[model samples]
Each structure stands twice: as C-alpha cells, then as structure tokens.
Target: MPSSHTSSTSRAPWRRHPRATVLGTLAAVVSALALVLALPGATSAAPSSPQAPQPNPPQPVKPGEAWMGAGVQMHEGDSTDGSVPDEGRRNLVASVHGVDVSSHQGNVSWSTLWNSGVRFAYVKATEATSYKNPYFTQQYNGSYNVGMIRGAYHFAVPSSSSGAAQARYFANNGGGWSKDGKTLPGVLDIEYNPYGSTCYGKSNSAMVSWVRDFVNTYKSLTGRDTVIYTTTNWWKQCTGNSGAFGSSNPLWIARYASSVGELPAGWGFHTFWQYTSSGPTVGDHNLFNGSMDRLKVLANGG
Candidate 1:
C-alpha cells in the first residue's frame, strides 16, 4: 500500500492519454502513471487494409532499430497478420500458460491476445488495505470492449497491523469483488518484499493469518472464494499450503519458467497458471499475462 507507483520518467509510452485513464482502483491508476509511458506519437498511421502496401523482404534488424509511429514499439514476428507461431516463441511449461500483469506493462489489444491464444488474466486491482492500482484502467474501461474475461487480484499485506482491516480495505476499494462469475475471482498476492516487511511479515503464522483473514472476509462479502498468489518457496516457508477457505478458493501458482515443461511437481490445486513473461499484443503495448483459451474457460465458470 505504500506507494507502489514508480517514477513517471521510467514508464512505457502507451499510458498517458484520456483513453488510458479509465482505470478502477487507485493502485491501478497510480501504476498507470509510473508503469506505462506515453509515446509522443504512438497513434497508428498505417493505411487501413486496401491502402496498406505489399509485404517487403526480411530486413536484418540492426541493434537499436526503433519503430516509426507513436506508441509503435516492439515488432510482431513474420506473418504480418500479427500471429506468433509456436516455432518462433520459447516453449512454455505445461501448467503455467497465463500471465500476471501490473501497470508497468502497457496497453493490451484484445484482438492480439485473443488471436495468439491467451487463456486468462489476473489484473491487479487493490493492494493491502490502502493502495489502489491504476494499471487496469484501460482494460476495465475499454480493452474488453473487444470481449475478454478478466478477474481481479488484491496485493495481500497479511502482515498489516490488522488482517481484517486490510481485507476490508481491498473489498471497499472496488465496491466489493466482481461477482460476474465469468471473471476469475479475487487473488491474494503474498510475496516477500524487503520494504514490505509489514505487509507480509517475516514469520509463517503471521503470513498465514494474513492470507486466511483476507480470503475469509472477501469470500463472505463477495459470495465468491478468493485465490492465493504465491511462489513455490513462499508456499513452503510462509504459506505452508495449509489449504484455502474451501474448494472454491483455488491457488494461482506463479513459477517462472523457460517453458511450462520445466515446472516441478506437486503444490496443490492450481486453478490457473502463469507460464510466460511476454506474449502477444494488440497495439504497441506488450500484453503481460496468459492465454485467451484459458481465460474463456475461467470465464465460463470452469
């Protein structure tokens, strides 16, 4: 909750616009200011379909080659259609197929994520009891205008002075969790932070109490179970995989991998898995999270 916002000068260029300002939680909003930057002229200039030019031969991209238009950042792979075939991308772990995004990553066009095969997304909303995130503004406001099922997650500060207080802070921020039953439910991010010692605490009981309290209160209030976000090490040392409030409250396991095949065995019931760091995108902004196929399943109440 203590100013997760980064300095504006360091952000990506896709964020600074009236259109990008449509975020929900304050944490998300602040993230927008810090995480994503606005390119001076990121707007699209390519001629629509018929007006576009024919394909050109492969040009070796020299070091530091930059794109031309505003907001025009990274380039798509071959197949000007914007699709990333399995051959070009790094292979992924089997379980981890989703992506976890903070405001730092810029605008995600639904079409790009959809076309490339994103399953689900856990958009950061509230953090601890006080910080509100601004990263979700675009997605909450309009990116879904193209239709993608999304869920919300609260950065858990179980080590807060009052665990219940932190839970209420998160619940109150978004007028309670989204009960659409289509979007993924709330998630409690229980990570270690050298500066966030108070948020997560240094002991196991404290962390467990913090996670349980938040999950319990959120479920009671929203009529939906809350998920836990943690790494394998944190699970063993801090959380202990003691089990959630019930079967409804699943685990969103985050384990970075060169490929999903690299993930180790046996943690607990994983409702969704985050497999990659960078995936496809609609505009210049890089989509930070997982696939659309998984997203639809979670959306369909699977």
Candidate 2:
C-alpha cells in the first residue's frame, strides 16, 4: 500500500501553494459584493425629512344637509319658500353673474368658468372651528388667479364652537379680506343647521347675539364687514327676522326664486342674491346687484 502511487492528497494544488486558498476565498466574496451593488433595489441617496401634517377636513354634509341653494333645495321640500328660481329668471346682462362652490365640487375648471361669464366666486373656507375645506387652496386661489373677484365663506356650526372662536379660525385659515381690487370681503354663511334643529336650538335673541359676535370678531380681524348668507324663511323662524345686522354686515340672501323676495328684517335691500343652485353651468349661480364698476368698488372696500 505504501508504494501504490503518488498520494492524491499530497498532489493537491492548494497544498502546494497555501496562499491560493485565501486569495480564492477573497475573490468569491468580492464577486458577491459586486452583484449586490448591481441590484435594482440599491440606492445611495440621503434620507428625507418628515412632511408637515395637514388640517382635517369636515364631515360630508349629510342627506338633509347642504350648502348654498343645495341646502335650500332640501329645505324647500318641507319648508315654504314658494317657487324656486330657474335659468329662465336669470337676466345676465343687468347683473354680475357669480357662483359659490364647496368641497362637494373638487378641482373646478376656473378657465372654463371664466369663459362662461362668471365674474365672481365665493369658496367655502371653513366649517366652525373644527374643519377647513380640503380644497381651499385650489378653489380659492384658482378663482382669483383666473381674474374672478373671489372671496372665502365660513359655514356656521353654532353649537360646536362659539362665534368668536369660529370667526378667528375662519380668518386664520382662509376667510380673510384685502382691499385688493380682486378680493371680495369675506362671507359669514349663517344658515340652517344641517346637523340638528333648524335654529341650532337657540332662542331668537341668542341666535342674533351669535351672529353679532361672529361678524364683530370677523371685522376685528379682517377690517371689513362680512356678507351674511342665509334664507329669508330661516331668518324669520329662527331670529324672528331680527334687523340687527342690516346696517353693518351686507346681506347675501339665498332666494332661489324669480325675485330676491322679502329680506330678513332691517336690510332695506339685499346686496348679493344667490338665484339658483343647479344652474346651466358648473356652480351655483348668483347676481351681484350692481354694475362692474360697483363690484370693483366693493372689492376695493368702498
């Protein structure tokens, strides 16, 4: 057995050169490293910073709830506001045609609206102190950028927060006014409470006081009186048709009818009239009861 042949273990190449085993191992390791670096999932970029949190959006208006004439449309079925206005009543030449939009409509076409003869717009900015329209920047800035006299409005939720608190929230968020010729004064949309009882369970005096507090606070912050948007019938039933706000705040009467109809209490005439919700165009239609020069004057804080 000792003389059989050259032993196979003694004839091994690595055994003859011990460094070749270590070099071969290192070469295999380097090949694997190159493969990992070549993979599609690999990256050499730096880490990113965290993004800021966005404000929460409000709950969707419920089945019986709405904004502008849409609210009135629902209210008219059970309530009395005889004869809703249609496109037949719209005399566009005599009055400024405008529209009001909320989150229900997302990412509107401002250019198309401009070409359609819409000269002004009111965008829903906030709902009480708890919510802001998620589409505010797009709706608010989009309208203004397109050469429309644009303003922001706050939906009243009297029960959830005080008037002062809500007003502050509105101003800090989007309901602000400037003397710029294109920006209309901010609006206070005090209308029927979609969440509960029509009057928000407030007595006539209490509701009136709430409205007063809101407009006062809003004025203190924005240096301009707010336009009050509401229905005549709701005002009659809830505030007992109080004429307290007539002298200061402009009335934005929501009457979906042939005429602007009887105003609330003290106001001798309505300033802005929302004539129709479902219109021939994209948004709710309105009439600014003045000429273009007068509308510009109002925007300039005349």
For model 1, how does the per-residue alpha-carbon lDDT over 62-165 read when each residue is reduced to its tens digit? 21111111001122122232222231132121212233444433444444444434434555566555556544565443334545456666665454446577
* Model 2 lDDT, residue 265, Cα: 88
* RMSD, every candidate, angstroms: 15.9, 30.2
What TM-score against the true fold does each predicted structure earn? Answer: 0.56, 0.74
Candidate 1, RMSD to the unseen true structure: 15.9
Q: In model 2, what is the error at residue 179, expressed in angstroms?
A: 1.6
lDDT (C-alpha, whole model) for all candidates:
0.41, 0.67
Give the poorly placed runs of model 1, Cα more than 4 Å off: 1-97, 175-181, 194-199, 244-248, 258-267, 278-302
Error of 1 at 191 (Å): 1.5
Instruction: Tell me which residue pairs clash in candidate 2.
Output: 85-256, 85-257, 243-266
The candidate scoring highest on lDDT is 2
- What would the per-residue lDDT of candidate 2 be over residues 187-254, giving only the tens digit for each residue? 88887776667788899999988988999999899888888899899999889999888777788888
